[model samples]
Structures are given as C-alpha cells and as structure tokens.
Target: MSVLLESRVNGANLYRRGKVRDVYEAGGDKLVIVASDRLSAFDVVLPTPIPDKGKVLTKLSSFWFGKTEKIVPNHVITTDLRRFPKAFRDVRSLNGRAVLVKHCERINIECVARGYISGSAWTEYKALGTVAGETLPAALLESEQLPEPIFTPATKAESGHDQNITRAQLAGLIGTDLARELQRLTLELYRFAHDYAASKGLILADTKFEFGFHDGKLVVIDEVLTPDSSRYWDAEVYRPGAAPASFDKQYVRDFLVQSGWNKEPPAPPLPPEVVRGTSERYRECYRRLVGKALS
Candidate 1:
C-alpha cells in the first residue's frame, strides 16, 4: 500500500512540519495543510507509516468541519484541489490529504472535553479523585460516563507533552471571561458530538480541539473529531472499570507499552499486522461516522 510520509509542493513555501501534518504557505492569508501517514506515540514519531491514514484524517476532519459549521465557524476554505493554488493542484498525492484554510493567530490552548472517564482523566481520578484538579463524584469507575461533560484545558506546548491546568489556572492565564467562553464552547461541542456518535453506535469518550482567532473571530482550527484527535469506542462493547477497544491510536500505544520499549525518543517500527490493523480501524471510524466509505 502506498503512503505519503511527507509532502512537498514546489511553489508553496513550507510553513511547519508537525508530527503528522505538513503545512504550506499558500499566498496571503491562506495555508495548505497536508495530513501525512506518519503516526506518533508518546511524543515520538514512529518510523512506519500507516497506509492512507492521512486521507482518512483529512476526509474525516472535512466532514466534521462541514457538519459543525453551524455550531462554530472553522478555518476551512476548500478541500477541492482545483480551488487550491496551481502548485498544490499539481500534486496528485495531495488530492484527499490537503486542505486550504484561512490563516489565524492561534490561541495557545488545547480545549478538551470529556464525556467519559478514561486516559489521563481516569489516571488522575483514580489517584486523587480529581480531574484537571477538579474533584469529581466518588467511586467513578474507569470508562464510566460522567454526569456531564467537563472542560479541561491544557497548554499547547512548543515541545514535549501538554500540561493540564485547572480551570482557575486557565482563568488566570487567559483571563476569566475568555476562559469561561472557551469552557462553554468546549462542552457544547462535546455534547453535540457525543450524542451524534451514539446515534452512529460509537461513544465519543473524549476529544481535544484547537482554536484560533481568524479576523478577530475565534474559529475551530486544525483537525476536529478525527480518530487522531479523539477517543472513540464501540458503544455496544463499552464497559466501565476498563478501557474498551478503541478505534483510535490507542492500539498503537498499547502495542508499544506491551513491548516494554521504555517511552522515549526513537520509537520502534510497527510490524505489518500492527500497521494493517491501525489502518483498518481508522477507515472503519470514517465509515461509521460518515455513514459512507471514504472516497
């Protein structure tokens, strides 16, 4: 299977090469973001690439962007290559992986919402009975649905892992009003998605979002609700007291942990089965959520 581990457009200046995406400057106020097959785990980019993974992410993000535009404005301009600049249009590999978007001054915060207890939230809850330093109801089981979704903000680190902050810390950093507004938006979006996912027979356990100020208006930016950015599970199989089989990168993380590689730089390459399984899961997520196969 073919995979685009990186992308290059002769006429477009490279803007930023993130862990899984390549960004390009596409003339004034516009940018071309290309998702790549590169997968990262424990803050390290792995050597093997998941086939067509980039397209799944790009397609899923575009679908959600269209679906949620009424709920919130986003930075998407077009996913159609013909609408892109000549240079981007010249690359056939970028067809389903690249997006044209309006440039924005990014807000340096990671807005997260959790409808179910899992991951670091479950970790924190087990240890301190608190998540993001906010106390929760006692005896919450692992993967148990919360009474209501809660907003947990984190710093968008320039390097390494993002540090979770308390609501008060967020208010102090970005001002109380702005912080409150971010929380409101995060929970509202999560609730909408969680309900929608349930109708599709999946549980949106938790997700994170990035926002930026475009023309002085805050809009959702980067990927939204894709498997890469959210924890999704089979609703029928979901159970409390343990993590369910997720349709996300958690499988890769599980493999790495079981191998005892010691989470550090220079991660190991994924085996053929691991790569194939991950690719299938990502595609399955797209199929289930969009109610159609990704073209």
Candidate 2:
C-alpha cells in the first residue's frame, strides 16, 4: 500500500504482452517479468484497477516458489528490486511485484493440475464425459471430486486463447517422455500444494504451471500459484453438491456474467465497489495461505 512511481527501465526490450503480464527481454538470457494492474474476467480485462492485486500475486508466487523448490527448479533470479541495475531499480519501489528471471526457451504447453472438478475440467466432464485425456468412472457428478489428480495440458497459443490438447497430442508436441514428465511433475506439485493449502483452511481447486528448458533441464518458469493462475475456495463452504464460493477472480467473473457483456470486443468496466471487493478477496487469500500479512 505504499505510494510508488510506475515506470520501467529503458534498456529492456519488450518481449510478449500476455493478458495480465508484460514480459521484457532483459538481455543475456534473462527476462524482466512485470505483473500489471490489469484484471481479466471472462477472458477480458476490466477497465479499472484492483489495488494491490499485482502485489498479492507476486507475494503468492514468491511463497510458492520457496515452498515448491524441492519439486522442480524455477526461473527466479531475484525478487529484490534493489539488486537490479540503477535504471531498473525503480521498479523495486513499486513493491516486490516484479521479478528478474533467467529466461529459457519456453515449452508451448500449459501444464494444468486439478484435484477437484470445476472450471474447464467440469465443463469438459459434462461435454466429453472425461477429464483431460482419460475417461472418468461412471457416477461422477458435475462438481464431484476426481478419483485422483490428473494432468490437463493445453497448447500455449501465441495470441488470443490457448487450446486444450489431449495427452497423445501433447506427446506429439513435446515427445512422449517429456510429456509424461510434465504430467507427472504437475500433478505431484499440485498434490503437495493442495494438501498444504487445505491444512491452512483454503482449498486449492486447481492451478496452471509453466515450464521451460534450461540447458537440457526442465525448469518451472513464469508465475506459479498466483490467484490469477489458480482457483481458491473457502474450505468451510466447499461442498460436493454445490459450487463453493471462490476467493480468486470468481467475484469479478460472476459480476461480469450478470452484466451480460458477451465476453468480446469492448468489455464493460467494473464498478468501483466490485474492484475494491475483489482486491480485498485476493489479499485475504494471500494472508490466509502464507500465514503472514503483506509487507
């Protein structure tokens, strides 16, 4: 909640602008990743700022990086803003929301791990009668829990939306061995974190993880378990028969769905109260998960 100037160093070349993040080539196999204030709901960024939302994501990612280091290597070089060169050091004052990470040739698949049925997994279950590439056992309800964790990989599109691909298709894209490794690691990481979150009174419904190759070694890159990349539900309200209240962007998405925006072209702006409520929910999630107040 500190007042800081919003600016970036001049030397870094802009890499790719994602829906919510801006990637910059920081020269010499390194990238400066910046999480923007943009809030996306129903595949569209709302036209209002959610205060401290970026900081909450950064904090959550940092926490998970530290927690999951034993599962896989990560690309984080430094989260301390002062360690950056003078030109880019000002970004530090913006709170520890930006990170300078070692850049690697990115894998084109979004590795998603789910322990519960919801979101696209629930939709797919209703449509194809299966989760990921495997068919579910008979008698699974809409929000029913999966028999076990599953790896649901999707193709990382260059622009627009990413397309979901089957395990066989993923094997074609990244070879059977590496594809299998991705699936294995993704579900293992999710299980570890999901159990940890449950103990803390939060439900980690699902999360998306990205990995890249660094010198023939696969390392987890980009953000890890931020609210934008994961769904969190209150454990007290989680029930098998009902869709539980979520702690992430579900607030914004629910509001947008009620607005009847068509989810295309010019998205409608969010009301001030909605922005404030959403921001508080993110903060609450971080505090409950990390067991510490944001610095």
Candidate 3:
C-alpha cells in the first residue's frame, strides 16, 4: 500500500511539520491539518510509514470532536472536503487525511488525564509513591485503575521531553482561573470518554489533550483520543498486575525496546511484520471506536 510521509498542498502557506502531521495556513482564520503516515516512538519519528495511518488518525479525531463538543469548544471547522475552498477542491489526496480548523492561540500545555496506573505514572509510583507529584495509595499494582482519574498537566517542550508539573505548578504557569477551568474540562472529558470506551469493551487507560484560546474562550485543540494520544486496552483480557495488550502504538514500542535500538533520531527501520502488525492494531481501534474502518 502507498503511504504519504509528507503533504504538499498548493495555494496554502506551510505552517509547521510535526512528528506526524503537517500544518498549513488555509486563509480566513482557518488552518489545514494533514496527518501523515509517519510514525513516532519515544519522541523520535521512525523511518517507515504505516499505510492508511493518516486517514485513521484524522477520522478518529473527528469522531471524538463530535462526541465531546458539549464539554468545551474545539478548533475543528469542517472535515467535509466538499465544503473546502476551491483551491483545495482538486486535492483529492487529502480526502480522509486532512481537516480545516479555526486558527486559535494554542495554550502551551499538555493536558493529560490518567485513569489507570501505568507508564511513567507507574514508574514514578514505584520509587516516589507519587504520580506527577500527587500521592497515590500504596501497594497499587501495575495497570490498576486509580481511585479516580486525575488531571496531570505537563509543559509543552519544543525539542526535549515534556516535564510533568503538579496542579499548583500548573496554576503558576497559566494562572489559577484558566488552570481551574482546564482541570475541570479535562477530567470531565476523560470521564465521559472512559465510560463510552467501557461500553465499547475497551479500557482507556490514559490520554493527553491540548487546548487553546479563541476570542477569550477555551477551545480544545490538536488531536483528541486517538491511539497516538491515548492508551487503549482490550477489556476482556485486562489484568491489574501486568501491562495488558493495547490498541495503541505500544506494539511498535515493544518491538523497538526488544530490538535494543537507542531512542535517537536515526531510528532503525521497522520490520515488515512489525509494520503490518502495527497497522492492523491502529485500524482495529478505529473500527471499535468509530464503528467502521477508515475509507
């Protein structure tokens, strides 16, 4: 299958090229977001591209934006290609992989919600009895659900890793009023998504969200609960004592860990089986959540 590692949209000014998505100025207070097939693990973009990955991310984010609109406003303008400007009318290559959204002044914070103890939280708890500086109950097993989901905010790093900050520290960075509002919205959205995923037979372990300001109002920006931004596990076989099989990019990360590759920019090429397996996992999550595969 063919994969698009980069997008070239005529008549639009290029904005930024992220680890997976390319942004462009689409004029009239709108921006175009194109999700590329490029995959990244451990803050490093891999050398290989997964087929249809971009379309899956775009569709899943749209599904979630529609699901959580009542909680807070978002930046999504429209995903319907037919309604796009005439300059992009012939760019059928972007049909399922691109979206036009309102341009907002993005808040430089990574709004993360954790419903379970795993990943960096588990690591931190093992040594410090804390997750993002919040004390957790002692003797909590790995992959165990927390007493309640918490809103853990992290700084938006430009080149290095994002450092986790406490609620107080978050308030210091973005002011108490905005901090309180974001914390409330983040937890509300997490609870709503967790309940929905449970009904679908999936466990949303954790997810990260980004927000921005539009005319003095907070609006959800960037990707929502897609696998790239979230951790998903099959509920049927989930256990608290060990890491469960997930629907996110953990499969690829596992392969890389076992390969003993240094988490650097010049990452190793993914094996054919690994690429194919990871592609299937992404598609499976989209099917389970959206009720259909990416067309």
Structure candidate 1, residue pairs in collision:
none
Cα displacement (angstroms), candidate 1, residue 15, comes to: 0.6
- Estimate the lDDT of model 2: 0.81
Q: Give me candidate 2's TM-score against the actual structure.
A: 0.94
Ordering by lDDT: 1, 3, 2
Model 3: what TM-score?
Answer: 0.98
Question: Number of clashing residue pairs in every model?
Answer: 0, 0, 0
Candidate with the greatest lDDT versus the true structure? 1
TM-score of each: 0.98, 0.94, 0.98
Q: Give me the runs in candidate 1 sitting further than 4 Å from their true place.
A: none
Model 3, 1-295: lDDT tens digits are: 4589998878877899999999988888888899999998899999999988898899999999999999988999998878777766678778889898999999999999999999998999999999989999999999999999988899999777999999999999889999999999999999999999999999999999999988888899999999989999999999999999888778789999999998987999999998999889989999998887667
Ranking by TM-score: 1, 3, 2
Off by over 4 Å in 2: 2-7
Clashing pairs in 2: none
Q: Candidate 1 lDDT, tens digit per residue, 8-27? A: 78877999999999999999
